[model samples]
Target: MGDLERELRDLSTWLETPEPPDVRAQVRERLHRPARRWRPLAAAALAAVLVAVLPPTRAAVADVVSGLLRFAGVSIAVSPEQTTPSGVASPLPGQRVAGLDEAQRAVRFPIRLPAKLGPPERVLVADPDPTGACRVATLLYDGGALRVDAFDGRLNLSFHKEVIPPGAEWVEVNGDFAVWVDGPHVLSYVDRAGTVHKESARLAASTLIWQDADVSYRLEGARTQAEAIEIARSLR
Candidate 1:
């Protein structure tokens, strides 16, 4: 977290902000089911996914949001070549150390842990809103080589945006659309207050993002798409 501290100290000035597997039709069918079980926001999110699909290819799903490419509630803008990964990651906003139980109790939704990776080494929670609910829960594993972050995306659009080149490919996470970033990227998000903030020192090696049961998650530092998806599908 070198320059990251400096950047965070300055703050106040920042901007914003997949895949297949399983049968493609299966993904569409799964997307359809959420609308019935969820409220209107889920419906809107489902509609976005469905339209990208009809009711989908990775390219077909592309929708420009705030002048950046977007999909599955995440936005992307390519990062510059000059900057390189420092092998360190930025913590989520308002993040604090906590036990797993304490972390789960803080969030409205379930904080799923990947069964494939067993228990995480550490649990962190971020409370960014006034409602006393955790906005994000992060699990760190393998000396931080693997990390999973779960956040409520039902009410937030463009919640996680990244600045990395456009080659992120599509993969499958239990029949839902997921995106994988193969290289390091700059991560940012819109807080509950709608202010933009940068995930300083956020140099992701590889990432897999998918939404399940209204929780949107991003798993970082996996070395390959297959491994990322396997861990993601094992979430429980």
Candidate 2:
């Protein structure tokens, strides 16, 4: 729990809001409809307006919170309407292939390689800031069948979100918090500039996400929780 998140959680409790109308049907109907995405500036402004008030607007956030699951740098909210399993995977924002040296050079955080997975078949970096520092680094194994993403815990994750049914498991990685999402889940990624890159939205593989040393690691494609933890433990 970061200080800011804790503060925001506390703030949510003080808001008084009436019940918002049930728009699940409306939302579900629009699920298949193509709609324009709000610009980042406009979206952020709308969020500020909604959160600043204490009515149905605040209730809207509370509704999401009822099913929200967050840890480390990842956030997952259970979706109201089940989406079709994701199609093909696509590159994220500013994503590019790199060698280990280049990947390490692109991000400020320390990169951990899983000993069990050995040398990654591919290394990728994405979301470069103005200074050329990327926000996330990914190491792919079995040609991305199994992979891990490493990023700073304090920034750049607000753009990522996931959706899963109930029953995500909670565990500990080397005494630190960890979570296991065992089934297909809807995934969405939007960059800092508000670009929802290619088809980053998809039903991601079963994942094991853990936090350590102020950095968050999201390990996807693990077949079992124990196997995921073993691989995570091997990060060095």
Best by lDDT: 2
Runs in model 1 with CA error above 4 Å? 1-61, 64-67, 79-90, 158-160, 199-201
Candidate 2, position 40, lDDT? 26
Task: Write one digit per residue (lDDT tens) for candidate 1, span 1-236.
Answer: 22322322222111111345434455435543433435434424433543443321122134323325455456666544526434455665778998999988998989887889999999988855777787888899989788988877665443445554554665667765677877777666666766656535455567888877777888889888899899998988
Worst 10-residue lDDT window for candidate 2 reads 56-65
Q: Candidates' TM-scores? A: 0.67, 0.67
lDDT of each: 0.63, 0.67
Candidate 2 on 163-205: residue-level lDDT in tens? Answer: 5565365666786557788777776665775554436576777
Runs of candidate 2 exceeding 4 Å displacement: 1-65, 85-89, 193-199
